[model samples]
Target chain A: MAKRVGMEVSIAVAEAVKLADADVIAAYPITPQTHIVEHLSELVADGELDAAYIPVESEHSAMSSCIGSSAAGARTFTATSSQGLALMNEMIYIAPVLRTPIVLAIANRALSAPINIWNDHSDIMSVRDTGWLSIFAENGQEALDLTLASFRIAEDPAVCLPISMNIDGFTLSHFIEPILMPEKAEVDKFLPPYKPQLWLDIKNPISIGLLGGPECYTEARKATDDALWGAKRVVIKAFDEFNQVFGRQYHVVETYRHEDAETIIVSMGSISETAMTAIDEMRDQGQKIGLVRLRLWRPFPEEEFLAAVSKAKNLAVIDRHMVMGCSSGPVGLEVKSLVYNSGLRPGISNFLLGLGGRDVTRDDFKYIHEKATSGQVQARCEIVGVFE
Target chain B: MTKPTVDAMAKVGDLPMGFTAKPGSTVAFKTGDWRSVRPVLDREKCIYCGFCYFYCPDGVYQDMGKDEKYYKADLDFCKGCGICAHECPKKAITMTLEEV
Candidate 1:
């Protein structure tokens, strides 16, 4: 039985992990991500969740231990934020190469120079090429649902790769929302116990993460990339199965009012909700604008994305991380490259906003629409609402 | 038990998932070719102290028991690191460069 209840998003995420019946949780305390692991620790302490909660000294060790546990055929999980994620950088890259399907919850935060702890995409963007299946959650409900689905998606024999579910720090992570938490039995029906295809077994020994010399290195990397590309099918299947069991539909790319629009805004994470409200207001006034929210970040839902924006003449891409020195932000670069390669010549304008915890209002979305439609937006990435 | 051999020239699809290999697969690769210098032992001067046997990094030197006067290097697995010769107390082993 699934019942709607008001709960913090972090706790909901923890509860979802528990329902997945994770065998091991290795994590270090970091802001925003701290609550998720802390609640997990409590769950383990109270005997609500039967899992090993390893309180690691650092994020690096956290991910390393996760790899070790997951290699030993345990359903392993961990959570981290800005600096924590950066610290786990080394192990993060190796996890995917080793085919350790560890589910990681990222409380998306801005990377630091001045050391600010706020919501942004900087943390996730830094490790974008780490070969992990990356997904974004626009709300608390999506966070919970996606976290649970991540286990099924990652541990699938065809897609034995790590996954990172990114939720905006403080915004979606700290917010208490009415999420329909599914019962354990329902979750069990949705996601069965994890059965690894390959593991570090003592009886039947096998070597993983071995040295890939020049003779086989390229093929090894190609195989990993192929596995990631092949994961899209499994992702869709899992989402479809999840919808069947939970009655909540999810897509790699979700659209809002884009059926008959000339201007479309592209965004990810929690800010898409704000953009949606702005789109509705503009629609009421007959502005012919809409939004395309990317729920799946990695292996970049190509066909779905192009279909979502094919009819649109103008695209306002909202990027939360600034790719310094580059012509555009990370997401912006990806979208532009995708559009260019696909031969779609939509006037894509990259807008950088909500960096290091800056507030992104509906008004900002409207302003972006104005710039995009009026053709006043430049070809380069523009930082919106910077105090001049 | 026989170890499975991975074909180095195998295509991306044919390769094992995650570059995994069976245990002791290194036996298929004779690393002795990588050695620039090979150890020559003086069997008559050898005291059978087992110094070369204990110090060989690759476990290249094998003790032939009480019958043999010195530990013999298994060139099939040896990289000719010279560690066995360097650690020999009786100076029974000497490293010599392989002639081209």
Candidate 2:
């Protein structure tokens, strides 16, 4: 049985992990991500969830503990944001290479110089190349659903890699929303107990994460890359199965009325919802615009993304993280390179906005549309709404 | 049991997932070639106290039993760190430069 209930998004994500029957949770409390681990610790303490809640001293130990537990054939999980994620960077890169199928929840936040704790994509963008299967959720429901799906996708024998489910901090993570909470039986039907292909067994021993001399280093890296690219198939299959079981459909690249539009606004995370509202308003006024929401960031849904924007003559690629000194933001760079390689010449305008908890209103989306369509958008990334 | 070796010619697809290898696979990778010096045992002064066997970092020194006069170094895996010579109470073992 699945029932819609009002719940905090972070708590809902924690509940989703419980539903997946995680064996261990090793996490340090950081703002935005703290509530999720807090709830998980409560669940473990109350005996509602039968899992080890390791209160690690730092985020680095949290991820390292997860790798050890996951390697020992446990379904492991953890959550972090911003500086916490940065601290886990070293272990984060090692997990996938060691084939540890740990599920990580990231509350996307702004990294610090002034030390601000707010919602942004800067945190996630920093570790974009860590070889983890990364996905974004635009709302509480998606965040919950993706958390469950990540465990399934990561533990699959064909895709034994770590996964990070990113939810915009404060905006999406701290918000209370009505989410369809799936029962344990339903979740069990969707995601069975994790069966690892390789694990630390005393009787039948195997060594993992060994030193790769130059002789085999390239081959090892190539093998991991192939596994990551191959994970897209498992992701699709898991989502399809989820649809069948839970009656909620999800796509790697979801679109909002972009089939016949002349211009498309590309965005990710919670800001896409704002873009959708703006698109609806523009449509009412008879402007030919739509939105393409990127749900899967890594193993970048190449063919699907190109197909989604193929008919559009103009594209407003909204990026929340500023890749300093680069010509464009991270998402913008990805889109430009993708389109260029695909031989498509769409006028793609990269807009950087809503950084460090700055509000991104519907008008901002409308402004981006105007800039993109007016053919005055520059080759350089535009920082929107900076105080003069 | 013999350790498994990764084929040098194996393709990317043929390699093991996660770069995992059989346990104790270092047995196949002989590190003795890395050594610039070798340990020489003087059976005459050796009291066979087993200090060399315990001190050798690579487990290179093997007990030759009471019937034999001294312990022996398994040169096939020894890296010639000279820990055995340093730890020998009888001073019966010495490190000698390997002939280039």
Candidate 3:
């Protein structure tokens, strides 16, 4: 119980990769994401872990190599930042269509115009429609834990989907902190070396990528579609197993004081910790407030989301990146879609805050919550944090 | 980039031609040889994106001769065989395996 040491989130993520026991680590160098692969590189080099480390030429090839390794039935891992993730965009759809449970760590960074290296949801949001399940981590501890859990959730027999776990770029990964590293024996009992039932093998000699006519295209898509929707239950089962082993409680939608509160702030990734601090401050000042931290974004927790938001009169959902024409932010777009789709009566508002690694303070939360409760949805889409 | 294995590419099977009213088809509705060429679109849940145009060989489908509501293959010229179905990215076209 006392072997705890100061570990950077990036290093913790590397340790989690060891626990996940990934068979292939395909990567290209990119900012904020470089150290994770570097640490993983040392592990593989030192013969501490048995795996193939392919130093791909580009982010596109990093994804391409992982796709091949995954198709050949290997548990694959990789890490990339803004441009690197954007470069592998097309393969994003292909990876899940093949139903490979490849786990990628996104060092959340801003998409370039001015070429910023700051933390933002821009990189992840761009690929939101690619059918990969995305999980967010609030700190280094969760950054380590969620990455391991992601492999389990993604590779579940019922789910078989690709997963992306986002850890804030300069914020969490580089920030040094104390972490309890689990023993290899415990991780071994929890996760087994991946044995794929279906794979691209020469001996089996079966065909994939066969042409399907209108007569059969629907069924292929249907299988992937149904599998994703079914993943909600799959994730819960995997999470339950994970919780029992690790002593951590995770739900589709994690609530803080939502049971008795009149107002709720919905968020994802590292901002949840800041939101909690804000909640504490607001509560001390006699505001009946709470927080809902969303962990999984794909297979968008429909019934659970309704149940969570049903009691709240006022809700403000924060999105780190805008969804362009259709909506302002990705999470904001999702929350609105769920609200409109289910016909739930919560007064949901969209808040586009903490973008490009802007440190969101307690004061920012107080202002957004107050405006949201006063029935101020200030845009054609809900763009929170604007000043006159 | 290394080329995709010619052997792997060679193994993709030819599409079936003309239909049979078999009791064992997974699809509920199948066109059985009446129209000479059967077009099967799987709507198990169709996103309805069209990819069949690029796939058809033999110039069987006239892009536009009369009406273009839906594309059709010239059956008289076609051997009643379905290569279009095999090449279709969406798998929306099916030709029943029939004797030429």
The lDDT for every candidate, in the order shown, is 0.91, 0.91, 0.76
TM-score of chain A of 2: 0.99
TM-score of 1: 0.97
List runs of model 1 lying over 4 Å from the truth.
B1-7
Report the C-alpha lDDT of model 1 over A184-299, residue by residue, as the tens digit.
89999999888987888889889877887787777878888889988988999999999999999899999999999999999999999999888899899989998999999987
Off by over 4 Å in 3: A379-388, B1-100
Which candidate tops TM-score? 1
Among all windows of 10 consecutive residues in model 1 chain B, the one with the lowest summed lDDT is: B1-10
Query: Sorted by TM-score, highest first, which candidate order results?
Result: 1, 2, 3
Provide the DockQ value for model 2: 0.65
Order candidates by DockQ, high to low: 1, 2, 3
Q: Write down the DockQ of candidate 1.
A: 0.69
* Accuracy of chain B in candidate 2 (TM-score): 0.84
For every model in order, the fraction of real contacts preserved is 0.75, 0.71, 0.00
After the best TM-score superposition of candidate 1, give how far the Cα of residue A273 lies from its true spot, in angstroms: 0.6
